[model samples]
Target: MTKFGKIIRRLQGDESGAALVEVAITIPLVLLLSAGVFEFSNVLNTRLLLEAGVEDAARYMARCSGDWDTCKGFAQNLAANGAVSSGSARVAGWLPGTVEITKISKDATDTATGVQLYLSTKATVDVVDVSTDYTYQDLGFMSYLGFSNFTLSVSHQERVIGW
Candidate 1:
């Protein structure tokens, strides 16, 4: 064989760069998957925190009495910050104004789905619903997975025992 033919055959038989090429191709995929998992966990954690705040507020309103406006204001503060007074929100970007405190009553013969939520438990009293809508702020990792900033909605309902 000629000199060029020998050189071509030798280069073709060499497998030294094979592992490097494989690693280079797979690194980006691994990184993307890891980032996606981290983003999902962060979003889930925020949702849990928001739900806890709403639950606390609903429980508080279930036993509270007095002025309707005052109770609602206090519930809003509690739902937003986990406190009945003004304080830092449990989740960033959450505000007291975003919290909604609603009272739902059931008639003796009402068959509405909302009122029948506790039918299995035989609860016949009124209910207090504490809810909030929050926009989640991500660390820019979710953009790679085709997800943008999304809204999280959290709510809790408690049976009211106060007249």
Candidate 2:
């Protein structure tokens, strides 16, 4: 036999659960990677949902003029049921059962921020402030890793009369 054949035979003779070793080394790595993907997907989905919620809330607030309860109830309903993955809890936690409208400028001023809208919505939530865990729990497999909380917050303004 050739030298290569002899080396191959020698290696084969030293069989010592190489497959198990490879799997042992690789299983955790794969799980960790997959867990990260799952976590990111969860965050991305929730972020999308939140963005949608923001749009809906802003739109609804722009269209309607209520004391406070009316707008918050509308926001909760829109954020919760609108997305493919419901965000009722997140919205509620973010804005709380009762949303306090900090400001409602009819003629909004233009700034370097972004938009100048006739309607601006701002609500402070004093629920638990544990969005990270909340969304982490919402995740599928990442929950097994005990990642069940995070921080999520944003301010949005849209034009009222324009669009």
Candidate 3:
């Protein structure tokens, strides 16, 4: 047999490195998938926690009949506490620094007798808007994919139910 033919036969029979090559190609893909799953889960959890905090603050403000400054302080405190309770250690500073409270006077309407009556003629209804901005920092693996930080803004509004 010619030397070239022998070399071709040897190359055709070589299967020893196939598994290694396959593993080398698939390992990186699997790792990337795992990292993506982890990062996504983290982001989802953070969002849920933020939602819970905002909801808590809104509910508190809605039920509070206190002065504007007192109500704002209460809402801020409640939101900070809620964040801590939600298992996010980084939310403490973020809440106070980013929390925004706005109060608006709105006309109340009553429709108990098949007719709309303006209740604000007697007393005004106050609505409180609470909003906060948060930054989510990628733990580690996601940083490798050029994801470092993301901004999340959450807000909730509720009317004061005081009579």
Best by lDDT: 1
* Candidate 1 segments whose C-alpha is farther than 4 A from its true place: 1-5, 108-124
Candidate 3's error at 5, in angstroms? 5.1
Model 3 ranges off by over 4 Å? 1-5, 83-93, 107-124
Q: Candidates sorted by TM-score, descending order?
A: 1, 3, 2
**Clash number for each model:** 0, 6, 0
| Each prediction's TM-score versus the true structure | 0.81, 0.54, 0.75
**Per-residue error (Å), model 3, residue 42:** 0.9
lDDT string, candidate 2, 1-163, tens digits: 9999999989987968989999999999998898888778767876766666656655655555554455556654554455323444544344433222233334343455656533445422111111111222355565566655665554455443321
> Which residue pairs overlap in candidate 1's backbone?
none
In Å, residue 61's CA in model 3 sits off its true spot by 0.8
Clashing pairs in 2: 131-150, 132-149, 132-150, 133-148, 133-149, 133-150
Q: Per lDDT, what order, best first?
A: 1, 3, 2
Q: Write the per-residue lDDT of candidate 1 for residues 8-67, one digit (tens) a residue.
A: 999997999999999999999999899888988999999999998899889888989877
TM-score, predicted candidate 3 vs. hidden true structure? 0.75
